[model samples]
Target: MPETTLPRPRRLLLLSVSAGAGHGRAADALHAAAVAEHGAEALHLDVMDYVPAAFRKLYTDFYLRLVEKFPSLWAQLYRITDETPPDAAMARLRRALERLNTRSLRQAIADFAPDAIVCTHFLPAEVLAREQLRVRLHCPVHVQVTDFDLHALWVVPGLAGYFAASDEVAARMRARGLDPSRIHVCGIPIMPAFAQTLDRATCAAEAGLDPQRPILLLMGGGAGVGALDDAARSLLRIEADFQLVALAGRNEDMLARLRTLAAEHPRRLFPQGFTRTIERLMRCADLAIGKPGGLTTSECLAMGLPLLVFAPIPGQEERNCDYLLENGAGLKAVDAVALEYRVRALLADAPRLQRLRDSAVRLGRPHAARDVLRQVFANG
Candidate 1:
C-alpha cells in the first residue's frame, strides 16, 4: 500500500473591525484557534487599521456615541436597516466605501493569498465581497455572525459560508435568502484559554482572593462603558459575604469611581483595569454581572458562569439578553434597584445559581474554533 501524505495546513486570513472589542476579539480567537487546532498559518488583521486614521476615528466615534449617548437612535437605525433589504442605492454606497477604505485591505489580502478568509465583522465581509466581484479570488470566504441576532448588513452575495452563533441566527440567515447548507451553527469562537480546565480554588487564590468565598466578576466589556459603578453600589447593599472582581477596562474614570466606592463600602472588592487574565477570573467566579455583549456572553457560557446582565444596548445586546433569559443561563436587571434584588436573590438561592450554571454549560461550545476550522477545510 502507498503511504498517504498528509495535506498541507491551510492559511487563514481572519479579518475583523475594531469598532468594538467583541468583533476584534472574535477574530483573534479564531486566529489562535486555527494555529492551535491545526498548526495553520493565520493572520489576524483589523480592517480598520488599514483604513485611514480619520475614517477609523469616524467609524469608532460614531459607534460609541450612537450606542452610548443615543441608544434610541441607534435602535431605530438598526430596526430600519434590518427591515429594509439592500437596494441599488445601498450597493452604490457600499461600493464607494469599499473603494475609499478597503484599498489597503485588498492589498493585504492579495499579499497574503490565504486559503480561507473568515470575517468576524461585517465591514470586512463587504470589502471581501466587492473584491471578489472585482477579481476572482478563489479562496473560500466565511462570515461569523458575532451576535445571536441576524441583521441584513451581514448578508453578502458572494460569501461561501456563514458561521452563526446560534440556531436562531442560522434560521434568520436562511429567512433572509441564504442557502441553508452554507450556514453552520458553530457558536461564537472564544479564546482557547477559556476551553482549558482550571482549578477554581487555585485561580481565586492566585488573584488574592479567598478560595472558600463565592466570587462575582463584574465587567462592561473592554471599553468599561456599562453601569459598573451603579452595579457595584447596588451589590454593596446586599449583605452577602462574596468577593467582587470588577474589571474596569480602559476607562480610568470608571476605575477611579469603582476604587472610591470600594474604599467607602469596605468590602472584599477587587478593582482592576483592562486585564488579559479574564479567563482565569472567569474560572474563579461563581457568576458574572455585566452587559451581555456577544463575545462576553460566549466567554461566560464557555466558563459555565451565570450572568446577571443589566441594560443591554438596544440591538444585539438586548437580543443576547433575551436569549440568555429565555434559556435560563442568565437574569436581567434594568436599574440599580433591580440589580440589587437580582444579585441578592440569585446569591441567596443556591439551587437557582446552579441551575443557571447548568444551562450555561449546556449552551457553551468550547470547541467552536476547531469546529469552524473543520468546516473551512472540510473539502480540502
Candidate 2:
C-alpha cells in the first residue's frame, strides 16, 4: 500500500498599520483565533514599523495630531479623500509614495512566504494590491474592514476577499465594483475574551466595582483622545445611582487627570490606564460611554453592553454611530449636556436599557475571529 502523508498547518501573515489602535487590535484578534482555534501558525506585523522614520511619523503622528487638534479639518479631508476616485492623479501619487516608503514590508512578506495574508488596515492592502499588479503574490491577501463604513481607500483591486463589519458595508463594496461573492459580512473581529461567558458580579468585584449599582464604562479610544475629562465630569455630576469606570488608554497625562477625578469622587469613579483586560471591564458594565471606535463598540456589543456614543469623530466614527443607532444597540449624544441627559434617561428607564442590550446581543459577533479564520482557510 502507498504511504499517506498529512498536510502541514497553514501559515498566516497578519498585517496592520498603527494609525490607530483598532486596526492592530483586529489583527491581534485574528492572530489569536488563527493559532488557538484554527491550529494555524500566525505572524502579526505593523506595516508602519517597516517604513522609514520620516514616513512613519508623517503617517501616524500627523493623523493623530490632525484628528485631535483639528478634527473639523480632519473630517473635511476624510470626506474629500473618500469622494476622490481611486484612479485620480492625487490618489495615484499617494499610493506611489506609500509603496516607495514600504519596501521593507515587501521584503518581510516575501521572507514569511505565508499561505494566507490578512490585513486589518487599508494601507498595507493598498501597497500589496499595487505590488500584485507588478508581480503576482504567492499567497492570497484578505482585508478585514475594521469600520462599519468602507472608505474609498479600502476598495483596492487585486484582493482575494474582504471581511465587512455589516451587510451595508458589503453592499457598498459591491457598488464599488468588487465581486459580490468576495465579500464576507463578519462583524469587526474582537479579542476572544469577549466571546467567553463572564460573570458580571465576579468582574465587578475584581475591578472594585459594585455589582448592585449600574456601572458605566467610559473610554477615549486607545490614544485617550476626546473630551473624556469633560464628559466624565458631566456624567459624574448626574444624580443617578451609577458608578463610572474610565479607561485612559496609553495616555499617562490623561490617566493622571482621571486619577485626580477618581480621588475627588472616591469609590464613585474608577480610573484605569491602558489595559488588556477591557473584556473584563465590559463584562461588568451596564453601559458604555465614549467614542464608538470599531473595536470598542464590537467589544461592548459582544458583552451585550449598550453604548452612549458621544462626539464620534466626523468620519468613520460618525458612520459607526449611525450604524449603532440604526441597529438599536446605542444612542448618540452631540455634546456634554446631551450625554448627561441621555445617561440619566437610560438609568431611569431600566426596560429601555435592557432593550438596548437585547439589540446589542443580536448584533454582536463574538465568534467573528474564528469565522474569519475558518472562511479564509476554507477558501485557501
Candidate 3:
C-alpha cells in the first residue's frame, strides 16, 4: 500500500490588540475565516489582554494618545528610524523595539506554541522576527499590514510573508528593499459581509434614512476626534441640504455632545454612538467621511461608496489619503473650511459625484477577502 498520512489541522494563533478598532476587527475576521477553513479549535488572542495591566495601558492607550495628540513627535521618530533607506542603523532601532516588546511576547509564544502565528499588530510581529533570528522557531510567522501603507515598526526582517492592502503598498515595500516575493497584495482583510451589495434605497430606508438626499457618514478612528463637530457645523453652515449620519466612535462624550448639537437641526442630522452595524450604515450612505484607515478604505471600496477624507493621522493615514487622492478614489478635506467647500461642490454636481462613485467601484475588489482565504488555505 502507498504511504498515507492523515490530514492534520495546524494550531494557529492570531495575535492582535485594540489599539484602534481596525486591528482587532481584522484579526477577528481572519481568525473566523481560518477556523471555518481549518477547524473550530483554532486559538486567537488580543495580545493586549495577554500582558500585564500596566503594559497594556502603555501599549494600547498611551501610545495612541501620543501619536494622535503629538503627531510631530511620532513623525520625527519615524524619520529617524525609517528614513535611512533600510540600513543597519534603522535595523538596530527596529530590533531594539523588538527586544523591548519581547518581555511579554516571549511569554505568549511559549504558552501558545502555535504551528503558525498571524499578527494583526506590529509589536508581536517584531518579537517573532527577533525570535526567529535569535532562536530556532519551527513555525512560520506572518504579519498583515492593517493600513494602506506600512510604518517601519511593522517591517520585520524575517517574516514568512506580508499581507498588504494594495499594490501601492507593495510598490512602497519594494522601494524599502523588501523582496517582492515576500509581499502579497491581498487587499485589506475585511469581513466577507462587505462583498454582498445591498440596494441603496432599501438600505437607506431600512436604516431610517432618506434615500432622496445626499447622505454623509462622518467618523473618526475609534478614539474619535474634535473634527466631527467642526465638520458638522461647516456642513450645515455651507447650506448643505442633506441628511447627515455621523458615527462618533467609542467617544461617549463626543457622541453626547454631537447629539446635543444635532438636536438643533432635527431633519438634517443623525448622530450615532459606537455602532456595531457599520456595514448596514455604509450601505445606506452616499459617501464615507473619515480617515483612510486600511480596513475602512477597503470596506468603502467594496461597497462602491466614495470617500471624503479629513484629519488623516500624520503617518500611515497620510500615505493612505495620498493613494486615494492619486487614484481618484477619494477627496481630501484639508480643513473644516475646505471640507465644507468640497462637500458642497461634490454634492451639487451629480455627474462628478457619479464619477467618483464609479472610480470607487472600479478600484474595489469585492472578492479580496475570499482571495486572502484562498491564499492562506492553499499555502497553509
Candidate with maximal lDDT: 2
lDDT of 2: 0.90
- Model 2 off-target regions past 4 Å? 1-6
Candidate 3 lDDT score at position 50: 59
- lDDT string for model 1 (1-380, tens) is 99999987779999998877889888888888888878889999988879988888888878888999999999998898777757767756855876688788888888998999999988888777767786757788999999889888898766889999998999999888888889899999898988999999889988888878888998878878876887787787789899999999999999999999889856578888998989999999999998898999999999999988888899999999998999999999888889889888888999999999999999998878888888987844
- Candidate 1 vs. true structure, TM-score: 0.95
**Candidate 2 local Cα displacement, residue 353, angstroms:** 0.6
lDDT per residue, candidate 2, 1-380, as tens digits?
Answer: 99999888899999999997889999999999999988898999999999999999999999988887889999999999999998899999999899899999999999988999999999999988877777757678999999999999999877898999999999999999998888899899998998999999999999999999999999887777775777789999998788999888888999899888889998788888888888889988999999888988888888898999988888999999999999999999888889889999999999999999999999999999998888899889
Global lDDT scores for all candidate models: 0.87, 0.90, 0.78
**In model 3, which residue pairs have backbone atoms overlapping below 3 Å?**
none
Q: Count backbone overlaps in model 2.
A: 0
* Native RMSD of candidate 1 (Å): 2.5
Q: Is candidate 1 or candidate 3 better by TM-score?
A: 1
The candidates, ranked best first by lDDT, are: 2, 1, 3
TM-score of each: 0.95, 0.96, 0.90
lDDT of 3 by residue, 108-152 (tens): 677767777778998788767767887756678888888887777
**Rank by TM-score, descending?**
2, 1, 3
